[model samples]
Target: MTPVRLAFCIALALSAAPAFATDEAPPQKATNLGEVDVNARLDEARNSLSPDTGSSQYVMTRQTIQALPLGDSTPLNQVVLQAPGVVQDSYGQLHVRGDHANLQYRIDGVLIPESIGGFGQTLDTRMIDNIKLLTGALPAQYGDRTAAVVDITTRTPKDGVGGSVGITGGQFGTVNPNATLFGKKDDWSFFLTANYLKNDVGIENPTASRTAIHDHTNQVKAFGDVSYLINNDTRISFMFGATNNRFEIPNNPGQTAQFGYLDVTNFDSAQLDERQQEKTRFGVLSLQGKMGDTAYQVSAGERYSSLDFTPDDIGDLMFNGVASDVRRANRATTLQADFATPLGDSHTLRYGVYGEFERATSTNNALVFPADGDGNQTSTTPLNILDSSRILARTYALYLQDEWSIGDKWTVNYGVRADKYNAFKPESQLSPRLGVVYQPVDGTTIHAGYSRYFTPPASESISPTSIAKFVGTTNALPDNGNDTPLAERSSYYDVGISQKLGTQWTVGLDSYRRNVSRIQDEGQFGAAVVYSTFNYDQGKVKGDELTVNYDGGALTAYFNFSYNRSVGKRIITGQYNFAPDDLAYIQDHFIHLDHDQKYTSSGGISYAFPDSTRIGANYLFGSGLRRDGIVPNGDTMPAYFQLNLSVAHDFNLTSVGATHAQFALVNALDRTYQLRDGSGIGVGAPQFGPRRGVFLSLQQDF
Candidate 1:
């Protein structure tokens, strides 16, 4: 059957299912007392499904998040950058352990499907109660996109009703307003949040100037969660989220035109009016309960995302000889179940199953000038062409693992997982994982692990260009082959140790290495800021990280440093996206990936006073990303650093319940740096970092 028909059938079946709850009177206090016990048991059961046995886990609580320069207003990607082995890049992207864009996100122990690559932020920081970043060799339950795992726990209300409203605005024509409401009564609980933002610096600037030309954005996001307690041992919950964002494509002025369109020849590059729109909606429904000695939870989820790129016809034709309007959309439906049960005195068994179905579509309307064999334009008038494609794919996975405790000093976990993917082609794999944790002394811990991984390319972002149809046009390519992206298979090894120096300080060191075949990576190869995936024949990546943390009565501090090296030998897929000389050189020699940075470091310190006032500061440093030299990715850009500071205070008013205010200084040193030079393989345009700015916010809680 077709994907459309399958989706329709599933929808019908879900609608026909019987409801689990109805209108009934609130339970008594005795029942609520029993619920307290069940909630703790459920939390423990959920924690067992995702074990961080032999991985490097970094956690940030709600208090830590609020202590940052921007507080809840900081983007999720920026928050993750504070962890070890995370490198920042242009367009709000993060590379962990020398791997490009392979992170998995989970909320409340439920997986959230990946969306198409874009410049907008989908998940808001305000909804997070606590966030954890897990890296290195992982356990058996984690599959697919495994560069890192972002595990998040959402906020929940205490008891009564309460809410907050806030507004933040600053330089660069910025304004933001947000509100949140949460409450619990009897057996029903709910939380909801909404926000709107408008800013001038949406995308990175194309030059080193203080302000970017034609760069502005408007965005709106909303999320809701509701749950009902069926009894002392069972509950049902539902979650939904939505985001709509629009951005203007930034431009670089003083560029000479290379081609003419119709009667127009000279056009101002800074005045070009190009825009992009992104929208996403997702929902998940879950059922949790316990029977006998087994604990289990089942969930169903769906997500839809779309992006549209509108081009300036005359400006684009004169600049690059081609003007394209692109539209892409993807929809996914998923089902997951997990169970944990204790066998004897020394063993705990955990198993799970997952399935997903996805459909993606792409449409392109392009106008191109007629060209000769020498790639010289022969006609001033442009003609239009329509190119479109669609794909349907499915994935299934099953895993089983056991955690065994030998004694008080040692623990081991071993498991295996099988996965089958049916997309443009069919593929299957069976991977094994093993991990050991040892505690030899007081306040000292050591861990070692090895894992085999199988990763499939993102289905929503794979759209092959029709090379033959563009021949004899200005949009033609120099190469001929267009191979489909393949799955990546790899072996990973990791070792780490953590020790406590005294009562207030702790330090850790970790090292990891991976050897991969058919390794996957992504890049922006078009005028639109969308990414495409490709494969390398062989890849090797290695990294080491050092971390130190301190916590006293009223002061806190942390520092992290990482060194990474990543190289790929051959471009086995997506040949049309590379030049012949670069491909030949890479086939013979190893070259660094475009997003790889050799050294990265971040540190922060915060202090709280007795008068309910807090002062905080943070710093970030990078050795720089790769650029083009004599060969592909042979040179690096200049190093750079940034500093930020914040001050916040609480106030109690007689008329209002409570109020808070904050002031922040971003990029305090006013340093200028380039993130991309637009000269490497599959690089599209130049981009620079943000300049200095000041921001202020006020909030009222009741």
Candidate 2:
């Protein structure tokens, strides 16, 4: 964007901040509406209609996430695309809105300090109950990751002894098996899930011929929460969970273009293997108290994680080294207290504050490998690497939110969070969030919201380790700078309207904006041969979205559209980096790339039957990702459409196995579309993705 245009937008945004401060209406209690608040991004659980879900906090209910189809369950990055205003970043990192990877991933609030080459951490979705993508500012109640925070809460067991076991097999000998167990009582609940699997790839990369890969993985999670009633007004609660993962990529190598592909033909490539392993555990304990019209709660938690990684290759290092093994360990503790006091008969004031302490350490095994003049590998080195470092930090914060109500017509929600870190750069920061809803009639409401939040640098940037082989010397390692601070802040604005339209119909429309300062740029080239990790300049983005939804008796439907206008300028030199680009998807149609959904659209419709039988279908269309057509990895995958359908029969089929059975067919049309070539080094993979597939299972409730 031009300097003049940017300046004008900022001016207009500031001037419009206080234009709609409305608090003169009756507050509507979500007692009946199974509505999820899009504004509270972090607190949408209240609007959720299911009791089996964790809400009023950052909780994801299993029923919802389990229903959404997630492709490539290996990498944790691809699973979060189901939410609004969130998308995967360039490469494989996730970018909340336009936010960068200067974010953090917490397992039950405990931090994971590991770097998968340039990718973030490997996430195990099978053991996850829900994932809360906290992209905005760090709420006072939580610590770390300014631009956004992703809280990955693993599945906890319920009160019964029932678990789900599943196996998904596709092209290239891929197998994913998952299981979940839940146990629940009147005052206690527990949920647990375990998954193990391995995959053989067929991504169309030029190096697909010379590689031999054998990868395996395992994930285990346990959750248990109990609430005791000391009396009627005073109660105590405890929630605890543990999670573990192990991934291994034996010997992943693919030939260069000259070596030729191993398989004559495939949907993509049948070679190229990726291996890794990770594990984490975390839990929370809290107490709730109530006196007269005052209610309060206090809680504390501890988290620990251990991760191990061994990559097969980088760029075209199809030969030479065996593997770059690395390990990361971290632990975190938090203390928070909050209360809600009644203001009067018609209004209530709520406020709270919290303090937290976190510490984490990671060690990278230094590697000694043979290299050519350009840092490309040629030969040598059996075992040469060191893994040990102390990386720690702490934070403190405070926040207050008040919901004011008048007679009937409008209400306002206002809150702000202030945070300060004990380590690294960046000063105390604040996130101010506000929202207003005006109900002109009983079935209609006009709502608008805005928030200002910033993101700090990520854990990886604080200290980076890299090893290089000089032309004549044996091996030398260079330190990635700690000079760049994790300091990036953004101001966001959203406006939309909602209408009941009657008892069976509802609709909404929304638009948003985000401008950030001091975005962390890890140079243009990813893991540059000479420079391990560096910093870059500033960036800006503005976008709009439109959505129309309808929910009725036996039938419900959804339609959504999103578009963004974004650009970045190099601080070192004012030029655009074309190689990696922004948080955009390239293999949109190829291999069903999720990020290509940008400037794209989606719609779905379903109906219910009287005998617990229902059927539905969905449609996806997009503009397709853009790519450098002239480059070797060039070639933009076009847009595509996928159709899916399923049927469930609820009956007393104790004879079959359990309570019910579901037979599902994915890629129902048997229509196979080309996915991105998975072996993307510079330009990315060039092969076709998966093909038509099927999945089946049976379940019983006790």
Candidate 3:
């Protein structure tokens, strides 16, 4: 279909969706609502009956996630990609609204500090009860990481005991087993989940082959929560989770080595055996209570993470003639307090304060040959050198906002935030936020807003690796100086409109623009999976999104369209990671960011049969991702599309409760595509997308 024709159809669907819900009862206004101090709660109520805020937000429930064609093995990133203006990259990271590493995470409205980067998704999908992705211009309550807000809610038991166990297997020698238990006994309640996974395609294939060499992964994760009620309005809770993972870096065969020294022997790059391992653990203790119209929540948490990478010593020495064994670790402690209360009648107040203390250390062991005074001949024997550094940082933040209801047709929210960080230097900023919402009729809502954002550099992102030992090796790059990347500060504006046609259809449009002084980004420059942060002198990003959703009882579906452009000018620091020619080309002109993708669209439709049978399908389309040539990010990859299908049946048994079985086909059409090109700017490891695969899963719940 033509673009204009497709746009017309989407508009029609949005207008027709409400017809399905016309038979349903009308929404009821809360009683004694003003007395409830709605702002005091963690977020919206479980039923989502709160007032509208001027921001673009998408919510997914556990049922919605399970119904996707990916079945039980889907990761959080894949689920998020279904949203507009979201794209997948080489690593497991998600780029939202054309910004890299700008997504912040929260559990039950409490911020979780950034942890060490890893190839595996730290939080398991099986443990999540609901997820919210808030984008565009945000209110004062949301600061730092202004690109997007990922709020996750964990499952909690309201009554008697229940649990489930399942096993899933698929192509590429994949095997996974998981279990979950949740329930309440008197005043005490608990929920727990654990899983283990092993797969052949742990990381993307460096070659175009269907399977990658030595690319295997083993991972285990577990989460547990315990809560006790002291009174009807008071409670105490504790939660903890841990993850361990190991992966072998995929290799490309028949490739020439990049290094040559005194003829020790022939070195092949394709025979490399590289590996990476990560271990992570975290815990949180919280207390929540309410008095009259006032509510409060206090929390304390700690997180520890470590990563180790081992390169193929023999192959690396023959190719680059230098080998490195690297390790890094981080420990973070935090304290947070949030409170909400109702003032008189027309206003509600909410405020919070947060603090974090972080400690980090990096170590590298490199082996290189020593050169003579003439620099003509070097000893074949290798010399071992060490480089290590340890540093500490602290960050503190405060936010306050007031929600005012003006008459019955308009609502306004205004507030400000202050943040300070101590690392390379002391940096701080005061940000102001304002949003206005208008309701002309019963079914239509319009919103507009502006916000100033100050995002401090993540401790893990700015920490420099020890490169002093590689000055004389082939792995060395032109180093002008060591200048730490500055924090990103920007101004954002957004506007949106949403309308309900009748009952089954909902349509919305949102647009946003951002102007930044310094753009912060990270990339891998060595054989390891670790990344280093760098800066772009200036940047501008603009995007627009359209969404149509339908809920027709037996059938549910959604469609999303987004177009975005991201451009940067000049490189401020970290010149050693880039090619000299590419850097020179971009110094005087604006170039597309390495992660930029011009157009993205996603949609899915699912139907449930009366006889316990269900089927669903989904598709993804991308215009193209950025590529690098002699002109520095002046090229683009070929556009590609992907489709997936799934089917399942539910069985009710008298003896075993309920049983479910499902089968899924991913990349069902077997389309081949490249996710990254090694020749691209800032591209470390080239990788291709997965080929066709079939998977099956079985589960029982009681």
Candidate 4:
């Protein structure tokens, strides 16, 4: 079936199910104490499904989130930048621990399938109550996308009917409005949030100018959560989220045309019109309960995402010899179950099973001019070529682990996981994991871990190009090989230590290394903004992170620094995307990945006054990503820094319950920096960082 049909059928099934009815209990009176008790029990059950073990974890609570410059209004990608070992890249991309876009997301201890690649944010930060970033050699339960795990716990229903409304606007033609509603009745509870945003700077400017030409965006996001408490040990919940976003592709003017199109030899580059639209919808239903001394949670989820790129046919053909209108979509359905039980007095056994079915579709209508054997355009007239493909894939994974407390000061966790992928090239693996945590003193703790990992490339990003069809076209490839991408197999090692000084200061240091075969990476090789995956014969990545934090009664501060290096050798797949010289060079020598950065740092400080006022400041620094120089990815750009500040206060009105106002200054120094110079392998265009901007917001709660 088509993605649209599958999505509609799942929505219908979820909607037709019985509402708020419980198998074990009828209906009971709702009280504040009863509600609190039920929520606590459910939270405990959910926690049992995930175990941190010896991994490094960084947590952001609601209060800390609100202390940022934009508070809950901040984009989800920006919010994740504050964590350690996270590097910021163009197009709202985050690379954790020297890896490119391999993060997994979980909501309420349930996995949420990844969506198609796009510039728009699929998940909203406003719905988050708490979020944690888990990294390093992960446990057995965490598989597939394993560079980082972003575990999010959403806001729950309040005691009574209540909601908040807010609006924020600033420079760059920005306008944003949002609302939230939450309430509880009897044994049923619900929470909902919706927001709309319109802005002039939807994407980073390609040039260093303060504003971008033809760059505007409209976005809408909505989320809902509803749950019913059955007796005291069982609870069922449903969550749904949706996002629709549209962006006008920013243009860089004053460029020379390389190719000529029919009757369009003198077309201006600045007058080009290109646009992209992105849409995502997802829903999940889960049941949580405790039988005897064992706690279990089962969930079913479905997600659909699509991206469409409409290009200016004549202008693109004249500039780059090809004009391709691209459409890509993916629909995924998942089922997951986890259970934890105690064995004897010192061991806890945990196990889980997960499965997913996905359908990925790609449609491309490309217009290209005929070319000669010498790669010169021979005709001004363009030929229309249709390239389309669809793929069905399945993945299954199972894990079993035991957490053992050897002594009062030492703990060990060991496990094994089995995974199978049935796609273009079928593969399977059995991997092992081990971790140890020790407390040598009252104020210091140490942890070390090792893990074997197997990661498959994203199904939607693996549409092999037909090299033979475009042999004599302007879009012809330098090479004719089209090898399928293979799953990555790696061994990871990690060690860390954390120490507390007095009662208000804490510091930590961590280091890790990974060695791999058939490593996977992605790049933008086409006019569209979507990414495609490829493989390398061998790869190595290493990184070290340092963190310091202080929390006093009314003051808080934090700092993070990371050093990373990633290199790969031999282009084993997707050979058509690379030039013959670059491929030959890579096959003989190791080269740095395009997204790697040598150094990164982020820090923030905040203070709260006695009069209910707060002020905060934060900064980010990067040594810059790799670019083309003497060799492929052989040079680094100049370093850059950004600073931001905010101040907020609360007011009590005679009629309104509470009111809040905030003012923010972004890029306080108005520094100009380039995120990309359009010269690296698979790098599309030059992108500059945001200039200075001022923003203000007001919110009312009832």
Q: Estimate, for each residue in 310-348, the C-alpha lDDT of model 2 and write its tens digit.
A: 553331122323234455655667776666565664444
Q: Write the per-residue lDDT of candidate 4 for residues 56-93, one digit (tens) a residue.
A: 77888778788889888899888889887889888888
Alpha-carbon TM-score of each model against the true structure:
0.94, 0.71, 0.92, 0.94
Per-residue lDDT value at 690 in model 4: 89
**Which stretch of 10 consecutive residues in model 4 shows the poorest summed lDDT?**
15-24
lDDT assessment of candidate 1: 0.82
Q: Which pairs in model 3 have colliding backbones?
A: 17-504, 17-505, 18-502, 18-503, 18-504, 18-505, 21-503, 21-504, 259-319
Evaluated with lDDT, which candidate comes out highest? Answer: 4
- Candidate 2, which segments miss by more than 4 Å at Cα? 1-80, 86-94, 100-216, 248-254, 257-274, 311-323, 370-388, 460-463, 466-485, 520-536, 571-597, 619-637, 655-658, 669-690
Ranking by lDDT: 4, 1, 3, 2
At residue 591, candidate 2 shows an lDDT of 21
- CA deviation > 4 Å runs, candidate 3: 1-52, 261-263, 369-380, 465-468
RMSD, candidate 1, Å: 9.5
- lDDT score of model 4? 0.84
Task: Estimate the Cα RMSD of every predicted model relative to the unseen true structure.
Answer: 9.5, 8.6, 4.5, 9.4
Ranking by TM-score: 4, 1, 3, 2
